[model samples]
Target chain A: MSMLPRRVEFHEEGPREGFQMEKGTYPLDDRLALIDALAASGLRQVQCASFVSPRAVPQMADSPELFARLRKRPGTRYTGLWLNESGFERARACDNIDIDGKVVFYVTEPFSQRNNNCSVAENRERQLAWIDRYIALGIPFEQAYVVTAFGCNLGGPVPVSAVTDVVRWLVDACADRRIRFPAFYLADTMGWANPEEIKRRIGAVRELVPQARIGLHLHDTRGVGGANVYAAMQMGVDLFDSSVAGLGGCPFAGHKHGGAAGNICTEDMAFMCEEMGVDTGLDLEQLVEAARLAERIIGRPLNGRLMRSGTLAAMRC
Target chain B: MSMLPRRVEFHEEGPREGFQMEKGTYPLDDRLALIDALAASGLRQVQCASFVSPRAVPQMADSPELFARLRKRPGTRYTGLWLNESGFERARACDNIDIDGKVVFYVTEPFSQRNNNCSVAENRERQLAWIDRYIALGIPFEQAYVVTAFGCNLGGPVPVSAVTDVVRWLVDACADRRIRFPAFYLADTMGWANPEEIKRRIGAVRELVPQARIGLHLHDTRGVGGANVYAAMQMGVDLFDSSVAGLGGCPFAGHKHGGAAGNICTEDMAFMCEEMGVDTGLDLEQLVEAARLAERIIGRPLNGRLMRSGTLAAMRC
Candidate 1:
């Protein structure tokens, strides 16, 4: 068997990424209810919302209000996504939310411009400039999100060297400022990566940052999402980002942008792990219930298969 | 990276298996049209229909008529499924249908009785009695299918020894009879398999039948269908049975009986193989078109993801 970790950490991104892709904005109470249900499902971390512009992503306009209403579960981490200074300020002002203060950099120039309205070079310069203010707000600028780390929509293949260079730069900057980063995420933003590409890129990232935990945010766009996860597990990657019921997509890119389907289904991922003897510290049944609730809240069938089929454990029971 | 095969053979079983699961019996002309489209999409082999009892499976009652009207594609192999002597005789009467004379022995007794209406020992005895007759008719008994090789709905956990014993019996019987059996398939009829289970079972089968090619016929009951494929591929097992649009379930067990979701989707499987540089020699776009046609014919949406999300290759193009 390929080498694998005995345990995996699945961080739920449904309340944030899954909701943001919806064409209709769910009621605030409904959204809060879904998050509470997810928290009860034994997930250690939940990405609650993104504090982006309401004009850009209307679905996330209520992030501050939602954060205030969030009943934070003990021993559970609740984080909010922040892209700009305004978003970070709003996140910092929230009562029950934790901010990652991640400086996002796209691996390709076209995706950086198309998705973020900035070039790769300009985004890097801007992020470096914001480090002092972000640090002053008691937010750590240690970790980074290498968006399109595998490939991009406009430019097909994002070079492995480019991703590693960004990681190395982050490491050097952190060392210069004496900041510690626990982990970094390689986001397959467009869901274009294969197992070979995953191995290549994850290997490169590990070589650059030997001490930091590596995570993968995979998409099921091409139907290889689970296969890609298996390959990453074989490579000893234990951190994954998934959304309930397989919800989420890029608003700028649209549903079909870069063939993005949704984030890997959280229930599906947890099912895979539990079946393979990898403890995820989750209740599969509760996750399935949460997924069903998510479907009701969204008023559409989610992309996940386990909800329809049921788990083997459940069947045996 | 884990060791993998350079090429994989994906046999399309959608028309046969996918259609049989639907509540609606698709018109013969529509079934023929979907099969023709699938053949044109570069799939080398397609299982067109099963010649089962009309009373048992009404959806497959038109097997004879469908086989008669099929537009045979040059260089493509078309096969039919048979369970008893009558079904085998019907397949032989057809012009283009190929029969495996597969003598099935379920790993668990309850599944054998529930699915095939015969106990494991009785089925084995009956199949052994028909071997001479099957060979005399020039229908090679070259392969067998071990139904519920992974687990059974009624019997729960099937032992690894039960599966290997069956394979060893086949190997010995074939060697004694001077017959060359090319392969045997391990069917996860209930889809109760994980990567670990796949590794364990496929490893045991290989150790016993050193020269025989091993194949996996996986279902998507618990959503690890793609993950199971990846695990098998890492173990150097490449042959898979997939239905277009992921349409299939054991009618005897029903959709919820054994946690049956559907078959491993053909388009989704082809997409995964293509993304990982494993050649399946199939046009994904044509497969997607076939899936759409299937959905229309069935008057319901199929379970495939690639149809909704499109392929990464198409996205790149």
Candidate 2:
């Protein structure tokens, strides 16, 4: 359909992406309220909550209840990211079965292995085992989407050929499954990817998976994240993964500058899209309001500017 | 000469552009020593110090002595800026034929009114008067120029037509004098020009001032300074005015987000030049050392990245 309508996928990782990062516990409702607004912002897909254990991401202790209170939007899909067998089973048992018409699962390779006490192989195998459960429940099992596919910051710049290899590996691994060929997504797990790197690797991915969808999950750690989106778009990569108001990151990865930082904010993405003539059917004013809610949920100001200043044009009006 | 060089020339603004904005007065030796490092970095034309009154520019009170201490390079020309009639008088007395070489006079119209209590036309009248006197005194008045010719922040954006009109007015007012076509430079008095604007105005200036030596004076309030430099250089505008470690603007301007908080750092501009294969012939390590000295004089960390991060290839090595 016109190469899959230029759509924006809001990945609300605040539960897993945001809370796992904070030194303090964000009350459950604080996150739920934010998720409710995010869903209303016309975002199609969201990593609503993760099914990891409390000890690992103690801030996400209430993933089950967090899902229970979620106000599912029509045409929206909720993905419960799992790092291991237990997280998958826990996610399966959670109160919502339909997931408002869509379901998917994701895990980062080395991060999953280290965080969940399992190898990348073990994590993939366990996640594959849960696909049938999703299929049997009459739900769409969005192929096993992998995260941190770009490179780990701790490990250094990932080779472009290595990224292409990951896409082929995922596609081949799921070749026999009933689910569609698993899509490959790249995440700047530590916000390290700049414009040049984005172009080089995005080109590598296209070469490896010409028919498959490629999503970019960029972080604004170096201030090049937004610009990287523009660069990737120039290279014909459109689908991107974003968090609202930049409300989330892996706390253990590092701080914002030298340490781990938040992903490029959804509103900022929408703003960038608006500027570049890409349409995501989002209400920017409403989206900004949603971002403000997210900032309050985490009790910290966000890194995004579009939310704070709105568009420069809007301010003049 | 052929066209404005797309490769922007970066001017280190530490001693003149940076410190003139500093509220606290720096010692003559501290200022001179800081400039020594900048000089070694191969900046051919440095705004070494201002020839304004001590009451007006206390930080630059000893411009003459500061010039005396500078280790003059063969190709380098140290320019001590002058703001008004009184400044030109001071410029003649401070002209050190042996060390500083020549005396150049310039002033900002908007700032002269705001800071010096004179109208722009009045200031120009004063400049025309002084250019003749400098000629009469046999001091090379040919090197003198003006700033804030394009637009001003507090004065707001001037119509390009108006700017051209002013240039024609300034040029026509010079009676086509041999030195009448002194370098016509554009300044971002409040750091407001974007990349697109830089391209539009600077390109327009190239067309209008076809034979006048053109240069750019930028303040990096917005983060788009580097990109703007790329745009300006691509348009063939060669000469640029920058501050070492991005020291620039009125200190009061730094208190605002859109003020002249940062000047284009000479080191960063050099890096851009190196990447783009332009010949700047700057010694970056010495520039970094210059940045450090500027930081110490200001008693705060300077914000230019090149001064802190070593060579681009150096890290990869």
Candidate 3:
């Protein structure tokens, strides 16, 4: 109980994650509306778009237009994701998007090849080059993402040692360049993590990088996402990456059975945190409204519980 | 970690809970097929029907016939829910249904009046009468359920003391009759419980009855159902009542907003337990099949995750 954080931070990734996986084209206006709604909901960070190829992700092809038109909230940090130098350059070109340097490494080579179209060594070299460019441009590093940190659908179960090894590598990479590693985000890219696995993996990462600010990017694909969030919070890991209305699914995850579910829902996670006496710094009603907006934009019922059932505060009133 | 249970018992409430809430009539064959599938899935206890009025719950009108035609599996305990003497008599008339005497008390008056069609006192008197009848018949007592034990939609937040008072009353009532009080099941009837609330309320209950086994009947209405389950498990509370394919919303919970979600999904919960090394004595594959069958019967996508994403073991294979 003592280990639970009194406050937690959530990064909204619905615009980037959700739309990218959706089947049809949504108007740029609808996307912007959802993003603005999320920013107004008091989320400190909002990943509004991804600078990926239109051919790869047709929905995110309007990334530059989204950034150009987005009404940026003063307190909220608007961010975008990019996987390579070309994507990074595209993100750098956006005036409204916050250009924070971040690096990514895959825990499994199979996922790395499938998602990034590169070998593990090739991806690392690309990341290192980006790190050098960031240093040269005086851009402060945001975090290092360890994708498939828990387990991979293509690569099977991930060992705690494998997670620790990734963290250790990222730490040493930053140390060698005299740059302090800002944070480490462990991503359950394929929704393979359970609550126990979450605790074990986080503990293992902490053991390797004792002072690193650890965060989670968990998928609710398997339905234990809320449990996983609670487990992480119990360990005082306050940072999380979530989607509004649980918008996105992993396009890379084997969707032959059904498409993978999205990240732990934002309003649902925020509602849980606030209910448990953890300060989420977000408005529940506003988040719910945003979730509803997301649902309307998607033109379907997204996998979010709080959006459907609402908050306890609303119920009490 | 040491407080976590090595094994947990799940009472399948899908057939009884799901059908009673669904709108439209389902064929007797479809209902029996689901119940039979659940029984064959290694579930020890399956609540197959509710012997309630056809006017109130048209879906459960076939409960008696359901019991008569159900293929009774040797190891499974086929059960039915009955609120009053008439319903009890209907259940007693069924040759195949297992009859274990159970009592219920409401934590709040408004919900008591609304759901049970009586005040708390009147409901208690009815339960007492049923208890006497059970004793006369030499029927074994199962457990007592504390409805809206966490909070109520109409009655607002329920205090910890309110729950313990009901438990204390039930304990004393049984003691006065010289019958030992069976287990206490704290039900989050309207999905009002958060993880912290679960821990706090369970702790309060344990203080009053340290020797008694405690169980949870949690709703995933607000999305913290999985988290609440984890919190209870950490306290070594092993018994749970879950719905297959996340079936059955509370018809009583205000549906003016979107209707309340169903119970914490059985396959999802079981998947979490199994992945965390908690023995459930149920087959994951069989449960997935059952969940799909539930979706097909309902003619809609049920709110279950494992049924879509699949188990980690399947991914490993």
- DockQ of model 1 vs. true complex: 0.52
Clashes of each: 1, 18, 0
Alpha-carbon local distance difference test for all models: 0.82, 0.61, 0.87
* Residue pairs clashing, model 1: B18-B247
Report the error of model 1 at residue B148, Å.
1.7
| Model 3: fnat (fraction of native contacts) | 0.74
Task: Tell me, by DockQ, which candidate is best.
Answer: 3
**Residue B251, candidate 1: C-alpha displacement in angstroms:** 10
Cα-based RMSD of the predictions, in order? 2.5, 7.1, 1.6
Cα error, candidate 2, residue A92 (Å): 7.5
**Which parts of model 3 are misplaced by more than 4 Å?**
A250-257, B250-254
Please state the interface RMSD for every predicted structure, separated by commas: 3.8, 7.7, 1.8
Q: Estimate, for each residue in A30-103, the C-alpha lDDT of model 1 and write its tens digit.
A: 98998888989899989999989999889899888999999988868899887777887888899999766667
Q: How does candidate 2 fare on TM-score?
A: 0.66
Query: How does candidate 2 score on lDDT?
Result: 0.61
- Model 1 docking category: medium
Model 2 chain A: ten consecutive residues of lowest lDDT = A97-106
Q: Give a tens-digit lDDT track for model 3, residues B204-276.
A: 8898889889999999987899999999999889999999989987544556546678998999999999989
- Using DockQ, rank the candidates from best to worst: 3, 1, 2
